[model samples]
Target: MELFEHLSLGFGVAFTPINLLYCLVGCILGTLIGVLPGIGPVATIAMLLPATYALPPVSALIMLAGIYYGAQYGGSTTAILVNLPGESSSVVTCIDGYQMARKGRAGPALAAAGLGSFFAGCVGTLILAAFAPPLTELAFKFGPAEYFALMTLGLIGAVVLASGSLLKAIAMIVMGLLLGLVGTDVNSGVARFSFDIPELTDGIGFVVIAMGVFGYGEIISNLAQPEHEREVFTAGVSGLFPTKQDFKDMTPAVLRGTFLGSALGILPGGGALLAAFAAYALEKKMKMKPGEVRFGQGNIRGVAAPESANNAGSQTSFIPLLTLGIPPNAVMALMVGAMTIHNIQPGPQVMTSNPELFWGLIASMWIGNAMLVILNLPLIGIWIKLLTVPYRYLFPAIVLFCAIGVYSTNNNTWDVWMVGLFGIIGYSFVKLGCEPAPLLLGFILGPMMEENLRRALLLSRGDWSVFVTRPLSAGLLAAAVLMIIIVMLPAVKNKREEAFVEE
Candidate 1:
């Protein structure tokens, strides 16, 4: 009954004219950018952070949330129509989706993706609403020590789940933590790693680092690729609706994907990318019925399951951030920056302190999902036309916009120089085969981890055993240790490597 009342308040807030308009804008922009290969929500949202400064927090968040999940819907379109994946989470879709397109089944492939994503997105949002309150209740029981332990678990989860060399991932995290140490110290009121620079008194801007590394850095990398690599499908799309047999085949796969994606998305470091891969793998392992398509050759189930899983995962990944104030992935890390920009400390208190913002954000997700379905299906023509824009024209525009966005944040040239520096550093990370996502997670969590660690030590009068003495803290630390151990096992390590390989 109480949940219903809260939902009523949420709907009332979301239904306002301004909020509805922003939601629509977000959905449209999300699909637009998502249709173009190589650009993603991370870069898009990072570039838009400064623009959100003037928006009401609820409206801003509603828009950003729409972009995040709406990308899941848009990404599948490109994955099916062309060989390129518009979003990282849609990489798996390229395998079967492109195949379906080649066989002149592009329309049904897209319909499956659209319908599956809608169902999964709605389910994921429902789970978020039902579970967030309980998680908040559990969060209030945590002390400083427990918070520290939880962050430790989060960082470790990032390291374990990150693709590529484990050693490289750890090094990237360490680099991020070191970078986070720059600027004035909060405790002693002294500059630590500022190098005596005047601007160092204030910590580096989150928008600067995010835009530099993800926005500009990605553009640089994309430009480095040869122009001959891109291949767009030129076949005209027809037969917009799926057949009755198509519905029967993909329905169960969608259900399984929704279940798997919702569960995995709540875990630290687990998000849409992992969920889509895991869902496709799960579907591959299932025995096929006679007369059904094979695993990779124009399989509608392949399109449906991964599309469903990714959207669901994108929606549910908000659980940890909204409840415990811990970002589970790099995109959520940017969301932390967004929350901080509005002076809202994300945690359990947010529910009690700002019910309108909390519930409104939740309700806007359902509205966004509905909007994505309507936008993605009929507007397919526009998205396909966007794919024709050449990279030579697009890259320069992206670079210019990124520079402008970075400069607008602080109205300072030093920050612009810093963004360029990080862009180079980000490019270096990629060249060295390091995943930048873990670096982002580490940077976002480092300051909070330091604050909690110091507070715990201060409370315990410098006793080192206080973390283990608290049962919840001890359990969390133990879980982190166990995850490390499991990830290090020979069998698991091999499997992890195989899982990340796209083909």
Candidate 2:
């Protein structure tokens, strides 16, 4: 009865004419964003943050949420058609999705991604709705010590699960933490690393870093590639439906990926990027059929699992943000900024104080997922045509768009300049074969961790034992330590390193 009433309220809020229109617009924009090369949702959301200033808080969030998942749906399209991933999460899809395209099975691959994503998204939202209350209840018991411990767990999980060398991942995390400390010291009012720059007083904008590393960085990388490499796979796509064998393979894979992605999404620092890689790795590890296609060779399960997992992970990543006031990844960090712009603190109180916003956001996801399925299937022809645009023509517009977006944030060219500087750094990382996602996660979470650590020590009268003495905090620390040890094991380390290597 309670669940039904809550859902009814949600539908009432989500079904408003204005909200529905914005949701539709967001879906279309997100699909366009995803179909293009060298653009991802993190950069897109950050670029569009200013546009939301005119929208109602609920409607603004609905649009952003739609954009997030809609990008996931469309990302697979680019991956399948061009072997280019519009989002990091779509990177895995290229392994088999592009191969399927080359074989004229592009239709099945796109259908699998769209359908699997819809199912996973539905299930993910259901889990978020059902599980958030209990998690909120659990969160109410959190003190400073527990919060610190929780962040530690999150950082550790990121390091353990991050792609590439473990040492490099840890170094990136440390670098992010340092970057996060470059503003005013909330405790002492002393600027830590501003070096006397006025804008540094407010700290660097999360959007600035995201645009630099993901947006401009991607632009630079794409320019470095040969023109031939940028050409779209000009393969014919027929048969807009999956065959019976595809169903047999994709059903189990989608279900498994959904469950895996949902569970990972609840973990701090775990988001769609991680979920997609982990799901593909899991599928590869599972016993292959006697004569079916292998992974990295057009296996349908490879397309379905990562698509489902990434969508599930994308939705569940909202769990920590909505319930605990924690952002799991760069995109969620942007969401925190969005919530604050509306004078809303993103925490447990959101449910009780703004029940309509909370439930409406939940309901809007279901609507958005359905909207994506409808919009994507019929419009497949249009999306593929977009790939025909050449990279030389596309990159300039993207660079110009990013410049305008960054300048709009503060009406200053400084952020634009910063984007260029970070673009170089991002390119360095790319050249060095390093992953940047974990660094962004660390940058977002670091300050929160420091604040909690100080508060916990203050309460403990500077005693460090409080983290270990409190039962919940102690348990969290224990789990983090166990994770570190497991990650350090030679066999596990080698396997994780191999698992993330793109084919």
Candidate 3:
């Protein structure tokens, strides 16, 4: 009954004319971002953060949230039609989705993605609404020691679950921690790592790093590839809806994906990308029925499962951020920046202190999801035509857009140069088989972890045993240790590698 009343308040806020308009705009822009290869939600949101300065906080957040999940919807369009995944989470969709497209079933594949996503998104949102309040109540129990231990668990979880060499992931986290230390110390006003540059005193801007690493780095890497390699093979769209048989086959897969994605999305370092990958891998392991299409060849279940998982994961990934103030991934880290800009502190207090913002954001997602389904289907023709635009024409415009975004953040040329430098560094990470996503997470969490650690120590009178003496903190630390041990097991290591291997 209370949930219904809260939801009613949320709908009242979300249904306002201005909020609805912004939500629509965000969904459309997010779809556009998702259709374009390499222009991810993180970069787009970072670029637009400055633009939202004038809007109400609730409206700004509603729009930004729309972009994140809306991308999950739009990314599948390119993956199905052109064999190009516009979002990293859509990579698995490219495997069977593109195959389905080539086999002249693009329409069914696309419809499966759209409908599955809508259902999963709705489910994920409900789970979020149900779980967040209780989680927030639990978060109030965390002291500094517990908070530090939790962050330690988060960083280790990121390292252990991240796809690729474990050593490379550790290195990336260490590097990010070092980078985060450059700003002035909060305890002592002394600059720790700033090498006398005045701008370094304030620390490197988050926007610069995000735009450079994700935006410019992706552009530079794409430009390095041969033009012919970048061209897409778009299949024609004919049958716009799935067959009844297709529906039967995909429904179970979609249900499994939604459940799996909702669970994993709450974990640190697990988001849409991991959910999609895991969903497809799970489906592949299921025994095939005698007459069913194979896993990779025009399998409607293949198209449905990963799409549902990614969308579900994207929606539920908001749980930790809203409840605990811990960002689960790089994109959520950008959202942290967005919240700070609006002077809204994310965490348990948000619900009690700002109920409208909390519930409104939740309700807006349902509205936005409905808007995406209505917007994506009829606009398929337009989205497909967009793929026809050449990369040669696209790269320069993207580079310019990134430069302008970086420059506008502080209106400083140094930040622009800093972004360019990070771009080179980001490209180098790609060449070295490093995942930059964990780096962003580490960078965002490093300072918070340091502050918590210091506070814990201060409260404990410098007793090192404080971390282990507190029951909650001790338990969290134990979990982190157990996860590390499990990940190091030979069997688990092999299975992890096999699951992440690209099809």
Alpha carbon lDDT at 90, candidate 2: 91
Please identify model 1 stretches exceeding 4 Å from their true place: none
- Residues 1-503, candidate 1, lDDT per residue (tens digit)? 88989999999999999999999988887777777776678877887777788999999999888877666677788889877777778889999999998888988999899999999999999999999999999999999999999999998888887777899989878877877888788799898888788887787888788878877777777778777777776656788788999999999999999999998888787577789989999999999999988877989999999999988888899999999999998889989998998999999999999999999999999999898888888877677778878888977887788788888888888998988888888787767888788888888899889999999999999998999999999999999999999998999999989888877
Q: Give me the displacement of residue 322 in model 2, in angstroms.
A: 1.2
- The 0-to-1 C-alpha lDDT of every candidate, in the order given, reads 0.87, 0.87, 0.86
Clashes of each: 0, 0, 0
Candidate 3 per-residue lDDT, tens place, 213-321, comes to: 8778877776787777654655557888888999989999999999888988888885778899989988988888889988777788888999999889888989999
lDDT per residue, candidate 2, 1-503, as tens digits?
77778888998999999889888988888888878876778767866777787799999999999888777777789888889888888999999999998888989999999999999999999999988878888888999999889888888877777767788878888988989999999899998899999888888877788888877887898789998777575545689899999999899999999999988877666467778998998998888888899788899999999999989998998999899888887788888888988899888889889999999999999999999999998888888888888877987888888888888878989899998898899888889877787788788888889999999999999999999999999999999999999888999878877877898
* Model 3 spans > 4 angstroms off: none
RMSDs, each prediction? 1.4, 1.8, 1.3
Q: Which residue pairs in candidate 3 have backbone atoms (N, alpha carbon, C) closer than 3 angstroms, thus clashing?
A: none
